[model samples]
Target: MLFYNKNILIVGLGLMGASLGQALIKRRQSKDDFKVLGYARKQQTVDIALDNCIIDQGSSDLESMAKQADIIVLCVPMLSIESSLQAIKPFLKDQVILTDVGSVKDEVIRASKKVFGNMPNYFVPGHPIAGAEKSGVMAANSELYDCHQVILTPDIYTDKIALNTIESIWKFVGAHVVEMNVEHHDHVLAATSHLPHLLAFSLVNTLNHRSENREIFHYAAGGFRDFTRIAASETTMWHDIFKCNKDALLEVLNSFTADLDILKEAISSNDEQTIKSVLSEAKTAREYFTEVLQARSNK
Candidate 1:
């Protein structure tokens, strides 16, 4: 639970998994205790991870790696969670604490219950709000999650001991861990994280389709570039997250669409007062959120 003297198995050695391996190695924990083993579908990735010292040992084989782990952290995409869970279930040891880093949780929790045969006590659902526009092993950094928020979704069947132990693990990785239920976690992330990614992708696509001068995009500034930066994140990962949390994301998307429609109508009608009012409100809202974030950081 403390990750001390425990074999921590990380599946899918992408950015998150590789970064986790590095963080564990940098910690006071032993390489054997937090022995970061993994299994990538690519043998090249397996070799690269071992060569880079990002992992103790890894292979293209899941069953072999799963058997030797004390804790199995599923770091693949949300859509892959179910299949990964199924594939590794046959090899899972009863004493292992199984967890995931999926963006969406309701479907994952349900699928996990079935895969683990309704023993939700052994499962821990987590989502670390730290990543990059770039993915894969090459983009990993040991400090990717430094001071980042890691949300843990614990439900009725969730064991307190298991949840607390995982919290300790995230803390060791320098994450500020917080607890929330599945629905609350999904809904909040839908607005704060998922919706932004969705909008970023949409905004970038809209620009691509517009009849703008060829040099318009070339003249983008820091703010413009930063706004759309995350649009470059793994498409398959975001696509899977959107699908898993479809209903909640759709609800937020609908509300966002209605607001955009209102803004569009005001623009066409030359409603300068309406536009100013909206922009002023947006500025105030941003400032308020910024202050809150700053306060948390100072704490």
Candidate 2:
């Protein structure tokens, strides 16, 4: 048990943090190895988490909790992570292993270096590829991370022991842990996660501005619903993400735009072959993803 008899401090009682607390509490029911405590900027969020029994205790005093924690997981948005790290820096124990669930990692690591004067070996940056359009503690669930991918971006200076401990905790919560460098992680996520979300939000807004908006939504099919589901995600969180990871996001966006132009030209010029080729390629790519998901499930 990596967290055996440890006090795990989860900062931010939002969807990721609350769900992690629930998973830790569920694990404790059998092993009694770790205790989960929570901290949130809002007292109401802390109270809600306590009332839901997601956390063993809750507090707004981050420094106090940081001093007592064996592991600290920052589950706040990408932009808030820097401030969160700075808040706990004064009290952060040398032995404490720190990690985060922020989607963008390069900025988090950069912030860590700025605050600490160097990247601390105990700080293992991570991103969990699991979430929903829903936000807040009420949307949290213990099974949110089950079978999900959690990527850890650790450099050569990172402590191996701390890396192993963080990996073990994620695995305990039924996540498939993978390791990669910060740049690669950011680039991959920009293409796979960020671009899709941006497109979803943009598409929804475009449709909403049309005169037939109500009719469009009323007659929307499952495909439209599935594609735009992420558009309902918290605007503030995504706004921060876009700002923090603009470079990688823009690179992916340009590629996607080029693809869109190709399709637009194909249709405009009445080129049947080009249109069919694009559709066939997209279908193949999607089917490949389905096959990969099924294979992982079978394991």
Candidate 3:
């Protein structure tokens, strides 16, 4: 299950896929043990990836590329995972390892099970906790994953050798790899990543629809702009992620809504002590979080 001398195909040459290809291609330049290939639905995307040297070979054909791939890393949207799995299943070689860079793990597992009728032994579900608000092939960067966490959720059906090979591949790109079960991964992400994006999109959308939208945006401060930066991310991708992880997302959203109501009641009642206590606790928590990140970086 060694990745060395293998043909690693990256399906969907978008930001994540192209960045991964760039990282792998850059490393193989010195080692020359493997090759990096890319596939996109659009020929124009393949051409752009080739022009940027993000891949050793590029194509718009999935079947042809899947046939030659010793390992396939799906980098498509959450909703597209099932379709991609269905398309590539018939062409996958016996030992070819299947992995993905999807944010939601539960949906991926469900899709895999639905497509293959059971979990494929060589299919290891993965999610790299790395990305940018900006996307597409032109936004590809070789260092996008450096020092970031990559989570792998391997079930009993997952092949040990395939898991190890996928872990090694992530490490090769300078990522700190970790493992978690599908449920834990999805719940953690729902609270941390998905909720924040949901808030950002909601805030922006709410303000944009107001009658004074122009004046509101004109007077927006740096903090407001920074907090909403993720609102600028591609809509279709987030839309799919929200739908795929709705159960978990809704759980967290409900919790946040209850907390928000408490805050609103306190504000309406002018409860100084309640307001001060909540604010102080949040400030302390943020400071502790900063210290933790600093400690990790120093390590």
Best by lDDT: 3
Question: What is the C-alpha lDDT profile of model 2 across 1-299, one tens digit per residue?
Answer: 77788889999999999999988788665546788889998889889998887898889888777888999999998888889988998897778999999988998988898898888999999999999879999998999899999999999999999999999999988999999999999999999989999999988989999999878998999978977798989888899889888999999999999989999999999999999999999999999999999998887
Per-residue CA lDDT of candidate 3, range 1-299, in tens? Answer: 27888999999998999999999878664546898889999999999999997988879999889999999999999999999999998898988998999999999989988998888889899999988979999999999998889999998878999999999999899898999999999999999899999999999889889999878988999977976797988887899899989999999999999998998999999999989988999999999999988886676
Candidate 1's residue-wise lDDT over 69-107, tens digit each?
Answer: 878889999888889999988887878888889899887
Model 3 regions lying over 4 Å from their true place: 29-31
Report the candidate with higher lDDT, 2 versus 3.
3
Query: Better model by lDDT, 1 or 3?
Result: 3
Each model's lDDT comes to 0.86, 0.90, 0.91
Clashes of each: 0, 1, 0
Q: Which pairs of residues collide in candidate 3? A: none
RMSD to the hidden true structure, all candidates: 1.7, 1.1, 1.3
Q: Which stretches of model 1 miss by more than 4 angstroms?
A: 117-119
Residue 168's C-alpha lDDT in candidate 1? 86
Tell me the deviation in Å of residue 151 in model 1. Answer: 0.4
* Angstrom error at residue 199, model 2: 0.4
CA lDDT, candidate 1, residue 205:
80
| lDDT, ranked from best to worst | 3, 2, 1
Candidate 2 has its poorest 10 consecutive residues by lDDT at 24-33
Cα lDDT for residue 246, candidate 1:
92
